[model samples]
Target: MSGGGAGASRSDARRNRALVLQAARSAFAEGGLVVTLEEIARRAGVGAGTVHRHFPSKERLFAAAVTDRIRLFADTAQDLSDVTEPGEVFFRFFASVARLATENRAVGEALETPELSAAGGAAGAGREFVAAFEVLLRRAQEAGAVRGDVVIEDVRTLLVGCLAMERRRVAAGDTTGVPGRMTALARDALRPGRTVTELPSAPRRRNSVECGVCGAPVAVARTGRPARYCGGACRQKAHRARRARAQGRNADAASAGRQRP
Candidate 1:
C-alpha cells in the first residue's frame, strides 16, 4: 500500500509539471515573460503554490521557455540542411525569428538574460545558427550574389536591426510597409556591388515639413525636383488647389453677369 501511494503521488507530480509547462508556453507566446505567475497558474488550472513548486522562480520559468524555443529553432534548421540555397534559408530563418521576437517582448527579454546566454546548450544552438548562416554566406559570396566584403557578423547585425525596427513599429502601432521596407533594405545592403547603382542625384526636397500622412520628416524641393507634398497629403493638396482656381474663375464670370450681355 505504501509503494502504491508513493507511485501515485509521483505520477501526479509529473502530470502537474507537464500542465504548468504547457500553460507557461501559451502565456509566454501570448503575453511574454512579464506575464504574471498568478495568470499562468490560473491559465493552467492550478494554484500559485503549484506553480512555485514546479518552477521555483520566474527566471527558471523564463529559461525553460527560451530553451524550448532554442530547441525548436535548432530542429527547424536541421530540417532545412538539405536546402540547396543556404543563404535564402539563412535569411528566412532569422527574419522569421525577428518577426516573432518583435511580437513578444517576454521572449525578447528572455533572449537578453545572462543566464540564458551562458547556458551551454543554448549557446550551442546560437553557434549552430551562425555556422549555418556562414555556409550560406560563403556560397553567395562564391556565386557573386552577395558582396564579397559581407561577413557573417554583418548578417547578424542586419538581423538585429530588423528586429529593432520591428519592435519600434509595434510600439508605435504603425506596422504599415515596415516588412516590405525592411526586406528592401536588407536586399540593398547585401546585394553584390555590380547590382547597386550610384544615384544620379540625391533625392531633392523643397522644405522641411512633417508629412501629415506618415508623420515622417520631409525635405523641401530643390531646383530640378519640385517639392509637392510629403505623401498622400501633398497629392491631395495639389488637386484641391486646381479645383479652387477653376471655381474662382467661374465665380468671377458669374459676378460680371456674362460681360453685360
Candidate 2:
C-alpha cells in the first residue's frame, strides 16, 4: 500500500474508534444493555462492521462503557479533591453515583452481577471508592459532625440502600419527595446526636396544642416557660384570644355591678 493510503487508513481507524465509543456511551445511557450495535453504528455515522471491529462483543462494549463512566465519576471526585469538607465531598460523590445508577439500569444491573463484583473482589475501583469514603467518614467523625459509630461499611450499606429505595420509589411513581426525604433521613442517620430508633409502636405525639391561626402544632419550649404557642404568629393569636376573654369578663362585671347598684 502507498504511504499516504496507509496514513489515511490509520486516521480513519482512530476516528471510527472514537465515533463508536461516543455512540456506545449515548446508546447505553439511553437504551441500556439492550441497545443494538447497528443502532450505535448508525448514530456514530458508521457501519455495524465498524462497531464490531472496535468492540468484538456486546459484553466487551458494555464493560468498556461502564469503565468509561467509572473513570468519569472518579475524575469528578478528583475535581473535588480541593474541597476541605470531607463529608460534603463524600456525600457528593455518592449523590452522583445515585443519580447515575438511577438513570442507567444496565449500570445498576452490572453492580448487582456476581461476576463484576468478583472482578473487584479484593482490590479495584470499588475498593478505591470505599477508601475515599473512609477518609470522609473519619474526617466527619473527628469533627463531631457524624456519629463515631458510622463506619465506611455502614456508609456503603446506606448508599446501597438509598439507591434501592430511590429506585423503588421511582418505579412506584412516588418520586415527588423521595430525594428530600432520603437526604433528610441520611443526614439524621449520620448525625452525631442520640440515635433515634424506630419502634413497632406508634410514634409518640407531643403534648401540645395546635395554633388556631396557622394550624401549626405548638409544643412547650424546652425552657418550660410557655404552653402551646410556638412563634410570633401563634403568640399574637393567643394574646388576642386572652384580650377578648378579659374584655368579655369586664363587661359582665360592669353589668352585674350596675344591676346590684
Please name the candidate that would achieve the greatest TM-score relative to the true structure.
1
Write one digit per residue (lDDT tens) for candidate 2, span 152-180.
66666676676677777776788476463
Indicate the worst ten consecutive residues by lDDT in candidate 2. Answer: 114-123
Shift in Å, residue 6, candidate 2: 1.6
How close is every model to the real structure, measured as TM-score?
0.61, 0.60
Clashes of each: 6, 0
Deviation in angstroms for 178 in model 1? 6.2
